[model samples]
Target: MRIYKVGGAVRDRLLGKPVTDIDWVVVGTTTEEMLAKGFRPVGADFPVFLHPKSGEEYALARTERKSGRGYGGFTFHASPEVTLEEDLIRRDLTINAMAEDDQQNLTDPYHGQRDLEARVLRHVSPAFAEDPLRVLRVARFAARYAELGFNVAPETLELMRQLSESGELEALTAERSWKEISRALMEDQPQVFLEVLRACGALRVLMPEVDALFGVPQPEAHHPEIDTGVHTLSVLEQAARHEQPLTVRWACLLHDLGKGLTPEEEWPRHIAHEFNGLKLIKAVNERFKAPRDCQELALLVGEYHTHGHRALELKPSTLLELLQSFDVYRRPQRFEEFIAACEMDARGRKGLEQRSYPQADYLRGAATAARSVAVQPLLEKGFKGPELGEAIKRERLKALKVYKEST
Candidate 1:
């Protein structure tokens, strides 16, 4: 059993990044041989084994063929005849293609180390386009490494463009697409992914709902022609600036996706846009195979504006009741995230110079205050059954009245 450290672990170590996961490549080893040696078999399409003690994954060195399209269109071969160099050559990026032996000997036939030093994201070979999933992976990598000044190779970008144009992107499952997008959103600079996707024409094909937002003018009150896409990007940037959780960031990035489907005539006054966006957000969640909590957060962001606007007029009891309607504990960070989304959206308006109301500051301060007051004894009286519920309800109403009178 020749064990060689491979992929992200080696790349991250070279880049001085934290290594969270480790993958091993076993050359000249069969799955049956691995099983006999006490490794637990795992992979179905590919031959991967789990170490009985460490639990780290060890995959047999293999090569793939694109028998279909999208993520599921591939067949893997892990026979002893498969060479380590051939396995590395089939990887999407050069930086991820390099491997290191148990004794720390390096094997980099693709010059992945050179690209890593230069901060470039180059394909392992011209054959990178064989797997359509590589396009999304490259775009995601661009987002993650934007701070390092990494740029995708021109040839690689061209192949991505070709794959996107050839409808290979459409073959990708929503879950696969979401996985790439989710990682991109979690990056410090997610706009890089969007920019790369736009350049490659993949954004429009893969997420046409979002692509439709480009250049769609907002009300004259919005400066810089803030379309849905621009607004979404702005929200994402704001979320990143605040260093919010991943779910919040994703919600902000996709908050206004439904605005594109709204009629052009209602551009700025999209009163029902939140509801519309929620449907699209749910569809996206299902497509991407997001967890239930994540879906809730995304949907919450989609309807954040409505909730914030309603909060302004709600009594304390009504507000608490409304807040209690959600599984807030399961997503403890959502309140802050909702506020962040609202703040970004409000600030991006065009006619801020002409507006009559203090919408931005009001939304910010109100959301903040609501969060603070909702934790008070009156709001959290620990009531359970009918009597407890009634008492809590009474306290909430009284509190709301006092708040309204003070305002």
Candidate 2:
């Protein structure tokens, strides 16, 4: 068997990036030969084996043909006769299709190295349209390599547009779709991911709420960017710039969904847009099966982010209500994430990215003051049952009032 390292490891190495995972393609190898050599069979749909000593994956060179719908619709054929060229042609991008032998020799059947040097993300073959999942994958690669000035080839984006317009993107599984989205959100240039998806018309098919935001206008007095969709992407960009967690990033992405639903007569003023956006937020969170923390933070940001932005101006009672809604006493980290998401929203506007968001500090101070209210004092003062709850609430409110006054 002739072994060659392939996919991201080779691509990243060629780009002078640190390779984290190594995948091997074994050409001229049969499943029985692999098993006899002590490789552990692990693939369910194709011929894949685990190295006996290294524990690395070794997939037999294989080719696929699109037989039906979605990404999983493809049927694979792996045999000892399968050539390395045949296997490389099936990859999603030209950058990932190159292979390297143990002797450090390069194989460039599809000109992946040439595309790499040109900083282009090109498809290996016309068969790129076969798998709807590659559309997301291509966008994600753009997010990853955007800092290096890499972009999707125009022809590749045309194919992506064709896939999106074909209605195939809707057939992808939620789990698979979420995997690419969440990864893209964490990239150094995540805004590029959403932009590429929108450019290719995939955003409308997969996330219409976000897509609808493109032409929608916001209050120019507050949002210099004007476009709700542009602001949404800027918010995600700010979250990434601050190295935020996934929950905060997810919340940032969904924070302005209500703006998309604003009436045309309202134009730039989306009064009660926060409440209008809650249902859309819930739908998106449910669609992707976001983690419970992510969902809760997103919901809180969706409904109360405006309150967070106006923390200094809000009454103590309103501030307390917001904190209580977040269960700030139970999940402090989530509350921090909520504040960060709000801060990103505030900074997302053009020319305001560097402005101070004192609202976050005020909210943090309010939470600390409320938490400082001693429950032991109330319990010792004959408080019990619902009365104890009321007593604690009253005391917390009193502390918040004093804190707000002092501030």
Candidate 3:
């Protein structure tokens, strides 16, 4: 049997990117043969084995037939009859279909080398639609390679559209959807993925709440001609450009989803959109099966704008009390994440930068100052746990009182 390095490791190595993981396809090897040779068989649905000595995965080169539906409904064939070329032909993308021999000799059966050189994401076969998860993977690849000027093949996008219309996406579990979206949101240019989904009609299927943002009118005083959908994309683009953390980025993307739910007539006069937005964010999180921590942070982002507004109006004692109430020391990134979300929200609106909103600036400054304060030092002092807690509470109240009187 001949072992061949395949997939991302080969693609990434060719691109001079850091190769963090390696996947190998062993041709001319049967499961029983591999087992006899001391490979640990691990795959339940396919013939994948782990090298007993190297601890790296070594999958038998196999061909697949669509026997069921969605991602899990596939029958695999692994035998001496399956060639390395046949194995490479079944990959999702041409760039990922290249293989390397043990001597590091490159094999490009489908001009995958050309696609890689061209920086294009092209499907290896028309059978790519057999697996719905490939759509998400292609979207993610587009997002990652946008800066490199890579574009998905037109025919491949057409296939994605067919898959979306075929109801295959409906078979996806909430956890699987979240897994792909979470990774997409974490990309440096998430708009590429979002745009792809939008083009393929998958966004409407996978995340209708976000898709609903498109074309929903925003107040003319605050924004340009774009609706809430366009504004949301703008905010997400800004976050991606800034290299913000995943939570902050996701918050920016979903920050304005509530606007779609709000009445257009009350656009400029609405007073509780943040409150409205928080509920919507929670619903969206639960729909996507976001973890508790993600749900809480998303809710925080929805409420963040309101909190900053309150901070601006509060007196020093109340402000301090508010700060003290939150365990900012332990969850220090929380406030910064909130501020980042709010900044993107404000910047996302047109002419808001010139509008008189000193409250945003004031609260942002306060959060920054609060972060530097060593709250734990006070805790470490002779003050007992209850005393320290009470002292902090009293100090915060005093600060709020003082700020209110001064304002």
Best by lDDT: 2
Q: Quick one: RMSD of model 1?
A: 4.7
How well is each residue in 337-370 modelled by candidate 1, as lDDT tens digits? 6665666555544443233334434444433444
Compose the digit string of candidate 2's lDDT tens values, residues 172-235: 9989999999999999989999999999999998999999998899878999999999999999
Provide the overall lDDT of each model, using Cα atoms, as 2-decimal numbers: 0.75, 0.93, 0.79
Which candidate order results from sorting by TM-score in descending order? 2, 3, 1
Better-scoring candidate (lDDT), 1 or 2? 2
Give the residue spans of candidate 1 off by over 4 A.
Answer: 220-225, 265-271, 306-334, 344-395
TM-score of 2: 0.99
lDDT of 1: 0.75
Candidate 2 segments whose C-alpha is farther than 4 A from its true place: none
- Best-to-worst order by lDDT is 2, 3, 1
For this target, which candidate reaches the highest TM-score against the unseen true structure? Answer: 2
Clashing pairs in 2: none
> Which wins on lDDT, candidate 1 or candidate 3?
3
In model 3, where do residues sit more than 4 Å from their true spots?
267-271, 309-330, 349-394, 401-407
